[model samples]
Target chain A: MRSNTRKYRLMILLCIAVTFFVFILSISIGRYSIPFWTVLQTLTLQESVDTTIRSVIFEIRLPRIIAAMLVGAALSVSGAAFQGLFKNPLVSSYHLGVSSGAGFGAALAILLAAGTFAIQLYAFTFGALAVAASFGLSRLVKGSSTLTLVLAGMVVSSFFSALISILEYVSNPLETLPLIVFWLMGSFNAIRIPDLINITPIILVGIAGVMLIRWRINILSMGEDEAQALGIDLKRIIGILVFCCTLSTAASVCIAGVIGWVGLVIPHIGRMFVGPDFKKLIPMSAIIGANYLLLMDDIARTLTTGEIPIGILTSLVGTPFFAVLLWRNKVGWS
Target chain B: MTFETRGLSFGYAKDRTIFENIGFSVGKGEIFCILGPNGTGKTSLLRCLSGISMPLTGSVTIDGKDLHSLSRAEVAKRLGFMPQLHSSIFPYTALEVAVMGRSPHLGIAASPSERDYDLAWKNLELLGISSLAEKPYTRISGGERQMVLLSMLLTQQPDIMLLDEPTSHLDFGNQVRLLELLRRFSKKGFSVVFTTHFPSHAFQLSCTVALMNKGTFESVGPAETQLTEENLRRIYGVDLCVEYVSKANSRTCVPIIKNDDGRGVGAR
Candidate 1:
């Protein structure tokens, strides 16, 4: 696979093409769909547009699309980071319990915050801080390895989740249980223009920061001992990466209510498409992830009268894809 | 560039001591092999000298500058290190893996320059591994990967090279080839330091030897002086022999493993 550089190049090209196609379809899809031409015209800033249609397309769809795109990219990049840091191909933020930490933060915001935008900020803040604290703790302890980090993450996540569950159990079910349930299932419906604005800075920083230090990340995948011999500051680089991934995870959770598998599935997809170089995989993972989630959200929204939780849909769709990957490995093609 | 660990001591943590009061120096153009058995802190000494771990006491100075004074990147720019072996899961290409050595020259957002690519390409070509430039590093044989790693170390263009058993996982031919490469590199004035169980490699190419028995250097001298039969026996704690043998009537000295009986096992 590494020999056939052309294969990765082609896979990347095809993914880009497919993602753009899906992005166009995602823009056109929703509760009162616009025509493809109208969508295109609006994008180009043409005149004589219907105000209601314009609001629906620009205000509702555009923000949702961006949120989907950012979350998708965030998950994949973070997933890749965790995998590289741990030096295990199977590691992800969710499995490391970063998701539960984030869920706790979001729940805390939901339970305590009074305003919508403030809650999103609070969730992102607490979420990123929680995982950062776990990493910090792991660093202080003696003889801490990746397994130790994972164990610490799980413990931290469990403690927070238990607190969240206690909060849920004590609250009025009629008022709060459905809110917690819907939040757990995950969604893109709650995001507004203001919410997107709140999430934009951190996502922007993470996306750009990851791309900037992308090669360092690739070197880091070699494991810290070798990387350190090669002159990398192992702890510092790992810290920055953990921060970026935490921020990315937090922002995504703030908007999407814990969308699963975008991080898990997209990186492998990007790797399959682009080999292991983060220079290529990072961006492709973001784009493909964004488009995948957006397309899935469109399907979830239109497939039934009742909205499907995005977390559920991702698990349903991604598990089979993950199996296909395992099967492909068995067949020796991938 | 010379490497020296003067009265150096190190531990994994505050209480765990691996080595103590170690002192040795490598010349600017020499292969100084650290010869010792396991649990003698061979790897720990290398780690301390390479600046990967701080010496609990004493100083490691490379090229007249103290190791602690130099930044990690600064030290890395002049020194290249290779551990035993690493097999990557991503299956990077030989060129790609080699190109990673250019990291010291890069900043946050910079791409590989033309010079960087040239260094990578030239190193691969120099190792006679130009054909593997496009091959997956994982797909290659263990010996080939070792060659690729040599190419990677060469790509760094360092004046000082530190290796922990560079030929441990390699085959006999690969061992010779790698030792030859290191010899050639030393001839170009790159100081090379390595630890190994094989003394013939040092006897063939290296100029000096640092023999350790406990937690410190017990003997340090010219290769012929420090790697003698008696010294090697004492260091390795085994009966051994190093003698010239004729292959097709040509004379060559080979280190032959001897049993306790201390007799040549076959025709020599």
Candidate 2:
């Protein structure tokens, strides 16, 4: 047991180191590339690098890097918490209709030619609204079983998705339609330092709240009756957890425009390495998720002159890897 | 703890009451058994005592304090509930499941500490399932899972235990083993209340027995006095013979199964 603890600690430390390296690498390797030393010199307040290179590092690359990391960590942590709360490994952060709702919100904002702030606000509101609808509909059913919630989520998701399609269909193909398509595809290109500043507290507080109750997630996963018998106030804890998880997820979607696969796949990777104890898994997922998305964004931006949408990149990589993970983790989830 | 119920009634819906106006009490170091057939309110009554469900009509009190008035943690610290056989979705290790028994004692932000881990290990050892600590709970057999749950309850260190059909899924050997463990717990000054379909289990354990039918307990008293053949017949809706075993110094119940022609199966 002691050795197992040592190994997991070492693994977590190693993951943090790798995430830091990837963060630096992502900032250095973008288009209109700055040299690694120049990036570092600018970051460290050295005057050797040119003003243009310094501006690229500070103004553009820094915000994108930070956005990528935050979105990754936020989505993955939310996914981990949701999976534990629902007691199903198959659950994703998107299973509750947040992505589809946010997608529609972004499309509507684009059609109305709203600024970034309004777009984000609209996305966050509608994302939360979608989940509320799902939960409310589930309660109206007889038992409010897990299956009912999942089905309600599907209903709300498709409803919002259809709204997005209608918005895209009516808008002129030359202007708003293309903009909506690209935003729905997802990117971190539009992120500025102010965007990062605005999202940081929500993500941090959400993550902290989840980590504090990480142990209880284990009990909650044991089914409602058993958890209640163990003295957990089921209604209060679950309500708080859902709020925290959705807060982060909505904040991420508002900024990044509905990135997929990170929330669904990163937590599974964390579980594969750390086991299902949420105390360990939540942190592991956070660090690994940050690194995973940063790496994916690096490839998305650097692979070609025209930037690839991160959602496309994530699904391209995530689906196959998750299939492999499911195959290997036969006993764990199945 | 002195656990008692007064005129308690409960049901999922307003119009349907599973049990009604039932009352009983068990002092420290006593064993209380509720025996009834399927669809009776034995499980519901146990749930009420554990504070998992509120009694609609009356009240349950532990040590003269109303059970509903206590916080969930306080109730959990005093009363340990072992639910019927359930399968967990995640692959939590046996030790982890055992350690969860300490949750009631933890603050909202606190995880189990080293001392808590030691207590869990000690309880697992006491239950003779220490070797299964590292095994996944989902991977264990039904009987071993029950023992693991028992170990978890032991780690809880509650003054009273409420078990709902604990031995329903166990084999005969395991059933006997669990009964022996309950007797040991009684000797250690823990009050036990369990629901069971077996009249023989009520007979084997030296405790107060309650025979329940419909919505109320038909009789409640020492097993020797309460578990009459006539009561068993009415409760079970089958004619049964309650006989004394001289060598074992115990009583057993055997159902008189009727053959196709209405003759007793044993007689044929």
Candidate 3:
């Protein structure tokens, strides 16, 4: 047990270091390709560095990097928490209809030619609305079982998905249609420093909430009766857990459009590295998720002259990598 | 602690009551067993006693405090319950499951500390399953999982324990081992109430045994008196032979073998 604890701690430290390394690496590898030393110098020297390099590092790359890290960490932590709460390893924020709702909201905003802030606001609102609809629908059923909630979420997701499609169909084909579609595909290309600053606290607060009640989250996964027997107030703790997961997932979707696969797979990877104890799993997932998305975003910027949509790249990379993780026996549902 | 229920009535729907007007009391250092047929509301009665559900027509009190009025954590601190064992979706280790027993003692945001871990480990030792600590609970045998659950209950340090069908899934040896453990807990001044489908188990534990039927306990008394062949037959609707074994110096209950058409061979 002592040795296992040490190994997990060491792995977590290594993951954090790697996240830092990847953050710096991602910032240096844009179209202009600043060297590592110059990137460091530009960050530290403030006003004294060369103007163009400083702008590229500070104005463009820095905000994007922060956005990628925050969105990744937020989605991954929410996914891990949701998986534990639902007691289903396959559960992710996407399945809760939040992402689909945000997608439609973003599509509608794009069709209306709303500004960036309005787009984010609409996305967050609709994402929240979608979960509310799902919850409400579940309650209307005779018995609001977890299975009922999941089914209701699917109904909401399909509804929002249809709404997004209708928005695309009605828009002017030349101008708004492609823009809406691209945004639906997801990217951090439009991320500004102010956007990053605005969403950071929400994501951090959400993450902290999950971390604070993480042990109870584990108990909740033990099933309703067992958790109740252990004196966990089922309604209160479950409410807090659902709120945190939805908050983080909505915030992530609002900022990054609708990046996929990170929330679903990163937690599984974390479970593989350490065991399923949420105390270690949540933090490990955050570190790994930050590194994974930072690297993917780096590829998004550097792969071709045009920026690859982050959503596409994640599925493209995530599928094969998930396969490899399974091949390597890292699927630690246990 | 004294556990008492007065005229308790409960059911899922208004018209269909599972059990009604039930009354019983148990004091410290007493082992009480409830025995009945499979669908006889045995588990439901235990659920009410454990405060998982409220009784409709009556009240359960723990040391004169209304059980329903106490906070969930407070109830858990005084009364630990073990439901029928189940496999969790996530494969948590036995140690992880055992440590969760400390939840009642913890704050909302608190995880188990080193002291809590020590307590959990101590209970696992008491159950004699300390070596299964690191094994994934899903990978362990059902009997081991049962022991692990008992360890978790022990870690709660409750004054009274309400266990539902505790021996349903255990092997023969594990069933005996678990009954011995329950006897030990009763001797240590912990009041225990468990529901069972086994009459022999009631006799083996030497506790207060209650025979439940359609709605309430048909008979409740010392195990030696309450576990008679007639009462067992009345509750189970099957003829039983409850006999004493002089060599083993204990009683065993078994169904009497019947020929075709549910009759004893000698009758034919």
Per-residue lDDT tens digits of candidate 2, residues B187-207? 999999998888889889968
TM score of chain A per candidate? 0.91, 0.95, 0.95
Better of 1 and 3 by TM-score: 3
Candidate 1 error regions (>4 Å)? A1-17, A94-98, A143-147, A330-334, B13-16, B244-263
TM-score of each: 0.92, 0.94, 0.95
Write model 1 residue lDDT over A1-334, tens digit each, in one string.
3234466568767877987778777888777888988888888888888888788878888888888888887888888767767766676656545666666666666677346666566667667767876887787787566667877787777877897798788766787667776877789886779888878888888777777778787687776666776778776777787777787788888778878877777788877766677767787778778788888888888899888999999999988998898778621111
Supply the global lDDT for candidate 2.
0.86
lDDT of 1 by residue, B68-165 (tens): 79877788888888877777767777888888888777875665665776788888888788898978777888778877877877877778998988
What is residue A25's positional error in candidate 1, in angstroms? Answer: 1.5
Candidate 1: pairs in clash:
none
**Candidate 3: pairs in clash:** none
CA error at residue B196 for candidate 3, angstroms: 1.5
Q: Pick by DockQ: which candidate is best?
A: 3
lDDT of 2 by residue, A139-235 (tens): 8997465567778989999999999989999998999998898888889988889998988888888888898999999998988778878888876
Question: Residue-wise lDDT of candidate 3 within B60-142, one digit each (tens)?
Answer: 99998998788899999999999886778777789888988999999998888878888989988887888998888978987
DockQ of 2: 0.57
